[model samples]
Target: ANHGLAGAEFLAGIPGTVGGALAMNAGCHGGETWGIVERVLMLDRNGALRERTAADFEIGYRHVGLRDAADECFAAAWFRLPAGETAASRRRIRDLLEKRIASQPLQWPNAGSVFRNPPDDHAARLIEAAGLKGLQIGGAHVSEKHANFIVNPERRATAADIEALIERVQTRVREAFGIELVREVRIVGDKA
Candidate 1:
């Protein structure tokens, strides 16, 4: 935005890195990372570098995967952004940041949104409707500010606590609305 790019302003409030954004096809307010990506540099497990385009990957809501199924990670990317006034772009960023602070659980340690929105419905809406907000499991709790967020406000929640809370939210939402909430955050490792 300092460069006066308009399309990337949606990224201004995301908490993770570019690589993570690319990996998850991250977006908010209808602007996905892959939507602006023109080309990307990837490093394979063997340390070989290669360039790929949008066509080289299968892209979907909150998902991206190499069509060739190669093991690789994003190294860099070139984006195609439209030019806009610097001031306007900066204002958009500021507005987005303010919106995030107002709506999200910024004071606690949490993964951004915990679940993908169901088709034609928001996960937060379903979660809140299911009475999951402020629901606690051990030291982690569903954020009162945003039902989609699972926050470790005291920093004392174990990974297991968060995981259990995630499952609890999923189960309750499913039972209430008959919609399965897909996770937006990835969990990897041996179970404790």
Candidate 2:
């Protein structure tokens, strides 16, 4: 069972499926889905099945790399957890969820924060200081509340528009602060 404990309760709010969660190592707040993983059940293309330990894979912040098995796919996972106070865990989850609702643009169709924070400094602070908050390119605009987030105000923005805006923000931030902002959101498909 997928335990949505602590700050991981945000996983329940995410619209993606379990398969996507596995593929992306999806997490939120301070909780990572893979942190509690003990073992994973996988199936090969030829229908062969196997069980592998979490230690058998390379686990990172938002990525998991399997060893020499690109053709295999995760079928399920065994997660180990310590017995804890249910009330406390539920309270913590509630608090984290409240914090996320208050801070993030949950009402919008955003793919979440556009860039990851670099080192000790925050990407939002950098973007805001660079005067990028509330900046807009077509229907895509940098969120005024959180500079690191780009929101779709009109919901009709093309990929090119978002790409251009992201590039502009990166360029401006780099030119002003000499910090290169790396994108967190994966951009796919051809540019229009």
Candidate 3:
């Protein structure tokens, strides 16, 4: 049953490197990758290698805290799980996939969720209430189907386009509802 089960079924759909998964604790639905992590192997800048237990790092929802040591990289991870019915787990995974495809704006090149759910509140509802759905900035637009997502409808959007749209949405939501929406997507690189 252990081999037949689909406990890590969500891992099959995520598009990220194993190192990214370990660093970000990437997950879908309610299953986090870190929940099953048993141990990690890391390499330092000087090429020194070490093994650390899961308890060695601070694991949080969708995030992992690394030590202050510079030039460290994740080498690999070990996972643990119990057995389950293979067919049933596969069916559950399929159902989840179907639901996501139907409800999310996956047809466009938008980063998944723009903002994390605030304490006891959903980001989508707040954005919708601010009248931001379908709002546009350059080639990027807020997905009408899902307010929390910003899609590049024109396919010509730069990172600046997306960043501006996100900030506009955040500002509007804050102004209208008095609640600050915290972004889920990590914005990197210099400003354009």
Candidate 4:
């Protein structure tokens, strides 16, 4: 809440470190992390850190410039928020969280959105249309409360179950709509 800059309220509801947020350009309610960035501090493999302008990045939806240069990474960031009231920023945060809780399956254990909204269409709508909501594979179930989310409501979803469910959702949606649903969440490692 220390960031009382004008328009910094958009970062209120996002969960993660500032570097992670900047890396993904995470946004919600029409505000994005990179939009507030004035400059960034990056570290190379050799422990050398340097300041870089926004121009140094090839930023886009859910990505930062370091994708091609894995040797360097984000260490810190400098924001360009203008002065504003802390109270107002806090209120905005509250409002954003309230809005999130109302629509998302906050009662369950889950990762956030599983797929990026494809072009002009929303992923949640597409998933819902595919009749995938509430579909369960073992302990992981596509959330009925929000079609885009997969929840481990019992806290028993194995990593493998979650991975299988994600692939199944992608296939089903593609078969039904002929549009390949691109994943927003990064998947890595061998399946257990």
Model 3 global lDDT (CA atoms, 0 to 1): 0.82
lDDT of 2 by residue, 64-133 (tens): 7786656788898877677666677777667777777788777776877788678889899999999999
After superposing candidate 2 on the true structure, give the runs of residues whose Cα lies further than 4 Å from its correct spot: 1-7, 10-15, 42-50, 67-75
**Lowest summed lDDT over 10 consecutive residues: which window, candidate 1?**
1-10
Per-residue lDDT of model 1, residues 1-192, tens digit only? 677677899998798899999999999987899999999999999999999999999999999999999999999999999999999989888998999999999989988999999999999999999998999999999999999999998899999999999999999998888999999998978864
Predicted candidate 3 versus true structure: per-residue lDDT over 54-117, tens digit per residue: 6777777666776544467799888886778878787887887788888888888887788878
Task: Provide C-alpha RMSD values for all models, in order.
Answer: 1.1, 3.3, 2.4, 1.9
Quantify all predictions' global Cα lDDT against the true fold.
0.93, 0.77, 0.82, 0.85
| lDDT string, candidate 4, 66-183, tens digits | 5355577788988887898988878888998899999999899877888889989999999999999999999999999999999999999999999999999999999999989887
| lDDT winner | 1
**What is the clash count for each candidate, in the order shown?**
0, 0, 0, 0
Candidate 3 error regions (>4 Å): 1-3, 67-71
118: Cα error in model 2, Å = 1.2
TM-score of each: 0.96, 0.79, 0.86, 0.91
lDDT ranking, high to low: 1, 4, 3, 2
Off by over 4 Å in 1: none
- What shift in Å separates residue 101 of candidate 4 from its native position after superposition? 0.5
lDDT of 1: 0.93
